[model samples]
Target: MTVFEQRRQALKESLRVRGLPALLVSHAANRWYLSGFELADSQCNESAGWLVITAHGGDTLLTDPRFEEAARRVWSDEIVIYSSRKMEVVGAFLKSLNPPALGFEPRSLCVRDYERLREFVALTPTEGLVEDLRVIKDADEIRRMEASCVLNERVMLALPERLVPGMTEAQASWEVERLFREGGASGLAFPTIVGAGVNAALPHAEPGQDRLPAQGLVLVDAGGRLDAYCSDQTRTFWLGSEPSDRFRHVLALVREAQRRAIEYIRPGAPIAESYHLVRRFFEEHGVADRFTHGLGHGVGLETHEAPSLSSQSRDVFRPGMVVTVEPGLYWPDWGGVRWEHMVLVTEDGCRVL
Candidate 1:
C-alpha cells in the first residue's frame, strides 16, 4: 500500500475502536496528511476539501469545483464536487449513512458552519483520531524533517554575518528568509522573527523598525520548510565585545535549563516533565514568572502539532515523534533569550535532530 493508503487503514481501525462507522476530516493538515491533497484552506470560512473515511475501507474526497483536478490527482476512488454550498452536500452524504451520528473533527469547522451542518445530521465531535498517527513520524517524514532542520540551523548561523549594528529588525528578518531560500529550502515554516534590544520581550514580536543598537541583545526565532516538513529554532545573541554580567548569568541559566529538559525526554516519559524541569529551574533562580509559554510542541506537516510539551499537557513521549525544546526568559525591559532545538524521540532516549 502507498503511505496514504496505509495511513487511512490505520485510521479505519481507530474508528472501529471508537465505535464510529465513519469520520469527516475537516482540518486542512489532516486532509493533506491522509490523502496527499496539498491545497490549503486560507481562511476559516473557506475550504480546499474534506475527507470522509469509512471503517469499511471506504475512500472518499469532497471538494469544491476549484479543486476538482487536484483532488483527482491525489484520490482516484470517489470524488464529490460541491459548487456553491459545501455543508449541504456534506450533510446530505452524512444523512445517507443514516447512522445515529457520524464523527467529525470540531477543529475543522467554524462555529457558523458547524451550526449549519447540525440541521442535516447528528454530528459527533472527535479529536486526535488522525493526529495520534501523525505524531509518530514515519521513516520518510523523519528524513525530510532532518533535512529541513539542518537547513534551518545553517540559515540561523549565517544570520549574524548578514546583520550589523544599527540594522532594523525588518532588514534582519528579510536576510534570514533569503538565507533559507538560498540554502535550498522551499519555504519558511513560519515568519522569521528578528527582535532587537528590548523588543524581544514580546514572545511573538513582529519584526519592526526597531534597530539593533551598538551593544544590545538580538533574538531570532526562525525555521525553514523542505518537502512539506518544517523546522523551528531560536537564538539570542549579544552585540557588545562582552555581554553584561546580568546577561551572561541569565544566558547560562537558560542554556542549562534547556539542556536538562532535553535530557529528560524519552519514550514513556511524561510529556509535562520536560516542561516542569525548565520551569522549576527558573523558579529556583527566582525568574519563574519570566519564563513564559510551554517548553515546546511537535513539528511536522504543521509548524505545531500533537505531543505538546507543556505543564497542562497529559501526553507521554513515544518513539518516532519529532518535537522542539525551547526554554526562554523574557523581560520587558531587558528583552529576551531563547534556546530551541529539535529532537527525535527514539527507543531509549531522544536524538537531537
Candidate 2:
C-alpha cells in the first residue's frame, strides 16, 4: 500500500478501536499527513480543506473550487467542492453519511464552527488521534528530516561569519531567511529569532533594531522546512575573542545539561525525565528558575509535534521519533545562552542530527 494509504489505514484502525464511526480531520498538518495534500492553511480561521474519513471504509476531501484540481490530484475518487460556507457543505456531507457519531479535533475547530458543526450531528471531540501517529517518523520521513536538519545546520553555522558589527537584529534575521532559501529550503519552520545582548534574554524575542555588539552575546533560534519536514536549532555566539567568566561558566553548564539530557534519551525513558534532569542540574547551580521553557519538542512535518520533552510532558521515548534538545539560561537585562540540536530516537539511543 502507498504511504498515504497506510497512514489512513492506521487511523481507521484507531477509529474502529475507539468506536468512532467517522473522523473529521481539520488540522492542516494532519490532513497533509494522511492525504499528501501540500497547500497550507493561510490562517487558523481560514481552512484550505478538510478530510472526512470513516471507520470501516471510505473518505472524502472537502475543499473550495480554488483547490479542486489540487485536491483531486491527491484524492481522485472523492473530492467535494464548496465555493463558500465550508461548514455548511461539510454538515451536508456528514448528514449524507448518517453516522450515529462524528469525531473531530477540538484543537483544530474554532468554538463557533464547533457549535455550528454539532447542530447537524453528534460531535465527538477527539484529541491526538492523528497526532499520536505523527510522533513516530517513518524511514522515508527520517531521511527527509535528516536532510532538512543538514540544511538548517549549514545555514546556522554560516551565519556567524556573515554577521557584521552594527548589523540590526532584523537584518540578521533576513540573512537567516536568505541562507535557508540558498540551501534550497521550502521555508522557515518558525520565525528566525535573532536576539543580541540583553535582547537574548527573551527566549522568543522577535528580531528588532538591536544592533550586534562587538563584544557580547548573540542568540539565534531558527528552523528550516524542507521536503515537508522541519528542523529546529539554536546557538549563542560570542562576538569578541573571549566571553566574560560568568558567560563562559553559564554556557558550559547549559552545554553539559544538554549533553546529559541527550544521553538519557532512549526507548522507554520517560520524556519528562530529560527536562527534570536538566532542571536538577541547573538547580544545583542555583539557576533552575532561569531555565524558563521546556527542554524541547518533537519535530517533523511540523516543527513542534508530539512526545514533548518537558517537566509536564507524559510521553516516552520511542524509536523513529525525532525531537529537539535545547537547554538554556536567560537573564532579563543581561545576555543569555541557548544551545539546541535535533536528535532522532533510535533502537539503542539517539542520534544528533
C-alpha TM-score for every candidate: 0.96, 0.98
lDDT of 1 by residue, 1-353 (tens): 88999999999999999998888898988998999996368776678888889988577898888889988887977888887877788778778777677788987778887798788777899989999999999999999999999998898778777778898999999999889899888888898888898888888889999888789889999998888899999999888688888889888988999899888889999998898888888999999999989999999998989888999888899999999998999999888988899999999999998
Q: What is the C-alpha lDDT of each candidate?
A: 0.88, 0.91
**Which candidate tops lDDT?**
2
Model 2: colliding residue pairs: none
lDDT tens digits by residue: candidate 2, 1-353: 77988999999999999999999999999999999985479876789888998998788998898888888777865888887677788788888899999999989888998898887899998999999999999999999999999998898889879777799999999999999998999899999998899999999989999899998889999998998899999999888777888889999999999999999999999999999999999999999999999999999988888877878887799999999999989999797899999999999999999
State the displacement of the C-alpha of residue 335, model 2, in Å, after optimal TM-score superposition. Answer: 1.8
Which segments of candidate 2 are over 4 A away from where they belong? Answer: none
